[model samples]
Target: MNITINRNSETPIYLQIAGTIKNMIEKNELVKGYKLPGERQLASELGVHRNTVVKAYGELVSEGLLTASRQAPKGYFVQSAVNSWNFNNRFFPLEKMIRYHYNEREKRFQEIFNDSVDKGYISFGGIVMDKKVNPAGDMGSIVKHMLQFDEDGEIMSFYHDDSERLKKNICHILAAENMYVNAKNVQIVAETNQALYYLMTLYLSEGDSVIVEEPIVPDNASIFRNGGLNMVTVPMEADGMDMDKLEMQIKKHKPKFIYTMPNFHNPTGAVMSLSKRERLLEIAQRYGVPIIEEDSQRDFRYTQERLPSLYSLDQYKSVVYVDSFTLTFPYGVKVGYVVGPYDLVDMLGRLITMTETFVSNMGAYMISEYIERGFFAEHTKRLAAYYSQKLDLLCSQLDQIEQKGITYQKPQGGILLWCTLDENINERKLFLAAKEKGVLMMPGFLFYPYGYQGRGHIRLCFSNVSDQEIVDGVRLLGEAIDQVKTKENCDE
Candidate 1:
C-alpha cells in the first residue's frame, strides 16, 4: 500500500487518507470484499496515530463504502457499489448547495438520538429540565386565560406592547444577578443561539475572527462556522478559560468579540472565577472588543453563592448578556433576551421584528404574567432543589465506578456532569455500546472543533432522567465502557 501524504498541506491527514481511499474504491483499485490494513498496522506504516486511521476508516464506513467484520477477519472490508449517485447532476447539483457549513456528524448524532428515543432508550443526552419539575400546572392557567380573554389584545395584536412587557420582566429577573439594566437595553430573541446568530450577523463578516473556549457549545460552533467566521479557541482550565493564553490569542487574532459562558458553562460545567471575569472585562475594554456573555444555566445552581455577572461588573458596558427561559421553564417556550447598550439592543429588536414579526408573543405574555404573579421566582427556587437531588444521585452512582478509569468533579451548580476517561478509552465506542444496551449519551468529540482530540471525555445531562433511570443507566454505561476496554486490550 503506497499512499502519498503531504505533511505541509492544509488538509488534515485523516481527511487526505479518506479521500485517497475513496478515490481508489471509486476507480475499482480496491474491489468489494477486499480487506484493508488494520488501524494499528496502517498507522505504523504511515507514521500517524491509530486514531487518525480509525477516523479515516470511520469516514468510509459512514459513507457506506466499508463494513466492519465481526468474525474471521478483524478489519474493515470494502462494500459494494456505494458511490453510484452523480455529484454534478442537472437538477439540485451538489456544487450549488446551500452555503451553511454544517458538519454531517451533527446530523448523524441527531439521527442516533431520534432512533434511541423511538427505541425507548434511557436518555442521558438532551439538556432538558425534568417534566416532573415543570411548572405546567401554573403555566397552563396563564396560557388558558390569555387565549380565552385577549385583554388589551396582547396576544392577538401585532403591537410591541407584549414585547415591551417581556423585556421589562427580563430586566427585573436580571436584577437578581446584580445586572442593573432597564427594558430599553433588552432585546427579546427566540433563544440564546438565535441571539448569538443575530449578534454575529450584525457585527461580524466573512473571515472575521472570534475567540471562544476550546470545547465550545456545539450550536455556537455551528453558528460561527455557518457565518464564515474564523474561530480562535483557548484551552479551558479548572477555574475557567486560561486567561494568559486568552490574552495572547486576543493580541494575535484581534477578534471581533469574545464569546463565553461565564456561569455554568456547557459541556464542561466550569464556572469562571471572579478574578478571571474582572481581568477578562478589563482586557476586552482596553482592546475595544466586546464580550458576549451567555448565562443560560445560572439558575440551576445546587451549591455556592452566585457571583456577579460580567454585565454587572463592566464599567465600560462592554458585555452583551444573553440568556433564555428554556431551562427555567419548559423546553418548548423558547423565549430568550439580550442585554447590551441601547443602540445595539434597538438594532437587534428591529431585526427580530423584521425576521420573525413577533418573538413568541403568547409565550412572552405568559412568562411576563408568571413573573408579575411571583410564579417565576417560585418555579426557579423549586427547580434548584429538585435538580440538586438528581445531581446528587448521578454523582453517587458515578462515585461507585470511579475505579473503572472514570472521574469527575462535582459541579457547584449545573445540570450536567463532565467526566474524564482514561486515555486508552475510546468515547465513540463507549457511546455506541451504551446505546446498544438501551442507554444514550453524548461523546466528547462532538463538542470539540477538531475530532480525535476529545476522545477522552463524555458529558451526561442528568436533569431529565429519573432517579431509578439514573441508577440503571450508570450501571449499563459502566458495563459498556468495560467491554470496550477489554476489546482494546485484547487487540493490543
Candidate 2:
C-alpha cells in the first residue's frame, strides 16, 4: 500500500502512478486478479488529483494490464491475460480455473508470515493450547487400552453412526450446563471449521445474506465469504453483540442465520449476559432464522462464572451449536461435533457422507475413552487452574509496567485477552516493534471480516505459554509499546 510520489518530477503525475503500479504488477508484488486500490484512495494518498489516478488506471486498461471482472467494487483486477479478447485464451472452465486459487494465496501469506516466528520468541499470537497440559501421555495410554480391548472388526468397520460412545459422553458432560440432548442430534466432524463450512453450504447459496457480529473469527468470516454469502455485521459491545442493532439488521437483511459466539468471544474475551442470550434466542425465534453458536470456548472458563449458552437458553430449537476439541486437545486429533434439530443433523450427516466420510476414528476412540474414564474433566480442571493463573499474571505484569493508554479486561474464561490502546497508538506499529523484540501478538484486524477497522485493538493469548514466558512477554510488550510511541513522536 506504500506508494510514493515526487511532486517536483518533470514526468506527468498520471504516468508516474501508472508506471509504479505497472512495475508492482510486473514484479509479482500484486498477484493475478489482485484488487487495485480505488482511484480516489490512490490519488488522495499521493496528494494528487483524482482524475490523475483515474487516468493511470485508464492507462493500464489501455495496455491490457488490468481487466474488470463481474465482481464490482473492485473496479480493476490485475490480469494474467494480455489480450483477454482472444477467444481461445479467455474461455476457461469455471470450476477448474478457480480451483486451488484461494489455497495458493493462503499458502503464499503463510510463508510470508512464518518468517517472523522464531524459536526463542514469546508468542502470544496463536490460539492453540499449550502442549504441556495437552494430556498426551494420558491420551496415549487410552489409545493403547483401546487397542487392547476394542475388537479389530469394529475398528475396521464404519458400523455405528456418528461415534455413539463419544456423543453419549458429550451429552453426559454437557448436562451440567443444562444442554440436554440425545445422541441423535450430534454428528462428529473433523473440526469446527469444517463443520461451519458444511453448515454454510447447507444453509447459504451464492449472494445469500448472513448476519455476523462485527470483529468475528476471521476464518469463520472467510468460510462464509468463500461460500458466496454476503455478510451484514452488527456491532459487538462489552456485554455481547448489540441486540437492538442486531434486530434492526436482521429485519433489514433477513440473513440465513445470526452467527455468533456468546461465550468468550474470540479476540475479545467478553461473555454474553444471560438476559442478552435470552433476548438473542427470542429474536432468532421471532425471525425464523437459525443461530450458529460456536460454543468452543464455553468450557475454557478460568475465573468468571459460567454463563448458560445460547443453545441451552433456546426454547425454540433455533440454535445450531458447534464445538471442537482442538482448542483443548492436541491439534492433529481435529475432532468436533454439531448439534441441532434432527432434520438438520440428518442432513449434515448425509453431507459428510458425500464429502469426508468420517473423522479419525482412532482419535475419536481415544477421546471417548478419556471422557468415559472421567479424565477429560480432570484435564479441564487442571487447565482452568493453569490458565487462570497465567491470565492473572499477564494482566498483573501489564499493570505493573504503568504503560499508559493500554487498557484490557482480565477475562473470566477463554484463552485470549483483548487490549485496547488509546486512539493515538497504532497496533500495527506496535506489532512490528514487538516482533522485533521477540514478542508476537495477533493484530486486532485478523478478527474482523471487513477493512482494517481494528486500529487500536490487539489480542494476546495466555493459554499457549508458560508463566515465565508470560511475564517476560508482557514486559517486552510494554517496551515495544514505548518504542513504537517514541518512533511515532520522532516521525511527527
Give lDDT for model 1.
Answer: 0.78
Clashes of 1: 0
Q: Count the backbone clashes (under 3 Å) in each candidate.
A: 0, 0
The numbered model that scores best in TM-score is 1
lDDT tens readout by residue for model 2, 301-385: 8654777888888887788899988877774788999999888889888888887566877767778877777888888888788
Estimate the overall C-alpha local distance difference test score of candidate 2.
0.73
Query: What's the TM-score of each model vs. the native?
Result: 0.78, 0.75
Task: Highest lDDT: give the candidate number.
Answer: 1
Give per-residue CA lDDT, model 1, range 1-492, as digits (tens): 667564422246787788678667755789999999999999999888999999999999997789988798677999864323212101110111114756865665565546544428788886656678877447667766676436665555332348898888888888887778999999888889989888887777777778999787676788888888888788788889998778766765667788999877888899999999999988887667788999999898877688889999989877899999988877478889899988888878777777764478777887888899898898888998988898899999998888777899888888888898875577777888998899888877677775433237888988778888999999999998788774232222
Candidate 1: residue pairs that collide? none
Error of 2 at 148 (Å): 5.1
